[model samples]
Target: MTPQQRRALDFIEQYYADRRIAPSLKEIAAHLGTKSRTRAHEAVAALVRDGHLVKTHGGRRNIAPAQIQLDRFTTAALRAELQRRETAHG
Candidate 1:
């Protein structure tokens, strides 16, 4: 990840940690000291592409970290991943 992408991801993770909700594009822009929500979105899109974040459709606060805590994997998440893999390979 680029330096700016890392910064955006850190801000996003911190925001979610504090509120248990993802930050909006506008909020992310302001935190990055920019007024352009599009720029903030691009940063977020990059993070999503790089697998540092995930975005679900049809919701205002749908973005989440692919892993809640990078260091520790949760059992439920592991099960979900295993199910997805099984479905995909079957």
Candidate 2:
């Protein structure tokens, strides 16, 4: 995923973990050091598009990781590929 998408995912995960609530577009923009909510919205949209996440509403909208239905082999391969990418990049 692109860095912005990753950051958006991180923000969603961290915020929910900390507060048990979803953050708004304004909050996302502020946390990412951007003044435009459009940019944050784009990032969030990418996450949703790539099947990495889903958005839900409970008064305010929230992002969460998508539920994967891959089999064990596919899941393992994906995990290994991610690890390989991380190791190579890091």
The C-alpha RMSD of each candidate to the native structure, in angstroms, is 6.1, 11.7
Kindly give the number of clashing pairs for every candidate: 0, 0
Q: For model 1, how does the per-residue alpha-carbon lDDT over 8-74 read when each residue is reduced to its tens digit?
A: 8888887876666899999999988999999998999899998999987767878998778643445
lDDT of 1: 0.83
Top-TM-score structure, candidate number? 1
Model 1 alpha-carbon drift over 4 Å, by segment: 70-90
Off by over 4 Å in 2: 57-59, 67-90
CA displacement after TM-score superposition, residue 34 of candidate 1 (Å): 0.3
> lDDT values of the candidates?
0.83, 0.74
Give the C-alpha miss distance for residue 7 in model 2, angstroms.
1.3
* TM-scores of the models, in the order given: 0.72, 0.63
Local lDDT at 31 for model 2: 83
The TM-score of predicted model 2 comes to: 0.63
